[model samples]
Target: MEIILWIGFYFLTFYAFLPALVSRIFGFRVFTKGRSDSGIALTFDDGPDPEYTPKMLDLLKRHGAKATFFVVGENAEKYPEIVARIHEEGHILGIHNYVHHMNWFMRPSTVKRQIDQTSDLIKRITGTRPLYYRPPWGILNVFDYANLGYLQIVLWTSLFGDWRKKIGPDKLYRRMKQKLKPGQVFLLHDCGSTFGADRDAPANTLSALTKILDDGKEKGYRFIGIDEMIAVTEQAKKKNKSRQAAKGSEARGQEERVAERKSSIGPIKKIVVSLWMLWEKLFHVLFKLRPVGDAHFFNYRVRRYSGPPLDLRNDRTLRSGDHIMEIHFENQMLFEMGMKSKTSLQLAIRIIREIEKTLPDLARELAVVPKGDQVKALYGVSMIHRGSEGLGFETFELPKGLFARLTNVYLRFLIRVIHPTGNQRVREHSDTLNPRMLIMERNTLLEWADESRPNRRPNRERPVESSL
Candidate 1:
């Protein structure tokens, strides 16, 4: 019996718990929230209740609000008119399985059947197949990740206990109102027939929802369907990328013109730049680096600090395994700037100016990311040590080891390849060019971000350095 229990434990761990952990913690293969500036998504699940859904729809329509309803196949099949009404009313229809049941207890094939039946039923009623699926209670089993490739798995950003009558209208309304800001996906229910749910719980939800819609509308919030919300977020991302690319092109064009006046990039330097950029691309893919807002010069990835404990300002100590945002310079941009500069000093000053311009943007972006507040520090390693103190970074000598030695070799090679007077610069600064760790604690970064003047240039007296 003990052996059998162990086997079951392992089975549940691999087949159910592991996948849920990955989806919940890492957000792998899931759309939890959006990035809209004013759009809010209201998603309802286990719904199409005869009593509540129509009322909710009426309230939403009166407020000119659109929502997404993840209707159960059984419930939707029973109330096809409600499902049709949802579609005709210009709202999104998504799947919530055939019956309200957790995916953890279902086999991969069973989960597929639950989804297919619901999708086909929705299409039969509404004449449109759902491209989105929200598993019961937003829980996923192992196969749900790859098996549901045809459907986008949606989770929620804000989940009020609206499925319980114990939480009254006032409390639910207050909770919903708190999440009224943009890019929020709210989880609500329009049915209470599922296990452990109060049969009339959606009554309170409907009651609270009216006030939420009114409040949100008054605040200039657009209550959109999940599909529209996702679309808007994607559009925003594409627009940001386009803007950044345009700025990068403008900078590159200006730098190229400057380079033409001084010395054109040699064929060897061009080859090196190409190879270096290719490696940077691969590294970004491997590490899943995200850009710091619209900033063109830096990208970062959250990582566990595996080094020795280091005490920082603000009573913070980053021990081994603490989370940190590992910052990386956009190498190609730096190389382009280097090509434009006649001297290393000029390149260094330009780099400092860029950091001063972009650090606040980075701080703002990080402040919005999930678990961003838990990050211990922003960390990087660089050979350039000057002006770090002025820019609010603490510099530490990298412990002598194989990692440090390899970093030293790689950075030196990068300098030689990217710098115009690479050989001469290396000869002159060899003694002071060792790599050092640069760290900015979370509080200090936020403080600096609050104080940053994006339009201002770097102080000429204290030029900052780049973490190349």
Candidate 2:
């Protein structure tokens, strides 16, 4: 019996007695305060009183001061207009439970209900979720702290024990001044814990509040709400973290991957890249085959890059997100035939003539792709059954014969209108198209070939067999 009694006593002591003891002895943080001692947050609890709250608001307004008010849900519901007024006047509201009790020692379900009810009530009244919450007396045991994040836990740096009448206005003010610091959150009372009290508590608080604000202003202290206080602290912490990261990066002897401002874009290199861009753009315009959203087109336009060679035999691989494009023998021909030339654009022009001779009747289709239709879904792959030994991509062919159309347009424009060249095939070793190399995007040459290899098409919605 004695052993059981001792266990019960110990548990009770830790639950009930420890809250006050911890608050008094250790002053341990239930949550961290603002990073600096340069600001003040004046918070009041147990408010929305018909008698005291209005007076407090008026006094605060007169001094051009704002505060965070933590009020009970029952009191808030009874006087919702007061709650709305508090929010309208630019003061933040926080949860202080539905009823004032030693809730920290209560069961988890009881505490959860208390918090949820209070949060809902405050949110409904003010049309905003209360950002902060404080269990009565800044106390929480094992179960009390569970899911406290439903409304964040906040505790004051200084509580003047203004709830007691004997402390009086004068004594409370003295305690407040003594405990005051730059980042201190001063806790005071606006109304009685239960409903119906003498106006003494609020009156004393008003007197104390004026003195503190006056003193704070003289010391160049900014009075902020709990939200601002938390935000400022978080900002300070992030800045400090960034500084530490910079130092660590410096220690590692590696700077962040910021673009280096080159002194000059070399004369020859700039000219070459510019000409290549012009040639590529014209190729797309003339052919009427713009790449699927950026992809090679975007890379050429803005983020310029050139692969070693092309692999036409690859499957349609995911280039960027969902858009897929054709991988052809153009890059291989460029590297093998045009690589010896100083300018790539000149060699590209030569290759266009050779492609025109290979397929003489090339022209732009002049038809717009149907809206909301995928290219692969709309056009089936046209399998040209020429033997693999002679042709580059034996089974790889774009639907609607796009390549043939592009070649015809190139030949007509270049041969008849502008300049002419010998239509000889630019031959290169098969090793030029490296199977493992990602010709464009993240796909290897072989992967691109596989997708273009053609397979059974996805099942289409056939007019809903019987839409009864």
Candidate 3:
């Protein structure tokens, strides 16, 4: 009976108690995901050790790749310069806790102290605090994660269990290579896995890195930091959130404006002016631009994703000084007063004519599609105006056309002078875009103005007689 009870106790520890302990201690969280279709994350934990970090940094430099090292507080203090070197080389250093203790064995105070001390040391060395944390031996606890909300909880998708010496480098390398995939965060150790003793595993880790690098190159994988991965993911989330908020806000706002238009003049103008001013402030904050004239533009600076076309040179030898302006207006009254009652169709024709005159060759290459069937449908463009003077443009969809690639170039003047809300539709569409402008040396609008005058004969004759 005694033997049987002992056996049952062991089984309970393994099956029930251990897993529950593990789950509670290491609250389930993924550090990095879906940041890159072609990028892999190389993460090191329980490190900043002298025996290996310098060499690893050297190897990474040779390969021209960056890795994130999760340094133990004690180790970072021992080799502050080595940690500094990691930062100087453009790599990332994240916290692996100070003492590298097991959470289940540690008190809450100890865990907090360990995290804080190590973070302070890293900051003192690198000038920027780490925003990512990896638990020693993958033993993360719920309280740990909750307390460390500022840091991301990183868990490995593939690891060689490389701290064990028994595993040969070949096996370790093969295991890692086979499991590697785009968007995977791989776990490797710099000094050794926190789990002590297993001779083959630790050395094999460094050995495996060379092969991992080569194999990843073969597979077209790029490597990025955990912070970068999480940032991109967060941005996508924020954009979606912002978009939803914008749609709801705009829809409700429009309805309110319509209702008020039928009822009151007393408060509506103030409301419009307030809304316009708010958007202007938002744009200024987001893009750091103060509008000039009646022209206001918002620029999106997206990192990590492929950006829009950057070439600003006049295509097809169009003179540098030539300029063209295309204005989009929802109100016919404003549109007419701004440009002498010119219809959108007529304006487009006149602008196209100016382009042809500036660069006759491009004119020959240009295929002007008929009015009703624009070469491609334009992206959905909306103008929101709450009152007579409050107006702004929101762009969402892109119409497919030959001009799609060049649309960003020609779009500067068309953006309305209005305040901007973080419109989700616009953010989602413009996520990977960059700020750009096209220069036409001679302002096409000016040329067209001169051409639009009928003959200029009677006024010219009167001026000449006065001069004589």
Q: Which candidate is the best by lDDT?
A: 1
Instruction: Output the TM-score of candidate 3.
Output: 0.46
Each candidate's lDDT (Cα)? 0.82, 0.55, 0.54
From the highest lDDT down, the ranking of the candidates is: 1, 2, 3
- Candidate 1 — number of clashing residue pairs? 0
Error of 3 at 426 (Å): 52
Task: Tell me the lDDT of model 2 at 156.
Answer: 78
User: Distance (Å) between predicted and true CA of 175, model 2?
Assistant: 2.4
Between candidates 1 and 2, the one scoring higher on TM-score is 1
- lDDT of predicted model 2: 0.55
Query: By summed lDDT, which 10 consecutive residues of candidate 3 come out lowest?
Result: 385-394
Candidate 3 per-residue lDDT, tens place, 1-468, comes to: 999999988865654445434553233454534445677888887777777788788888888878889898988898999999999998888888888777656766788888889889999999999888876766754467567868876776556567777767876776676556776688887876355845234567878888888888888887777777667667768887888677887777765664544353346544654565555444444543311111112111111212232222123232222222222222222222223212333443333332223332211111211121111111112222111111111122343455555664323222221112112323454544432222222222122224455641111222111000
| True-structure RMSD for candidate 1 | 8.7
Model 2 TM-score? 0.48
Task: Judge candidate 3 at residue 61 and give its lDDT.
Answer: 85
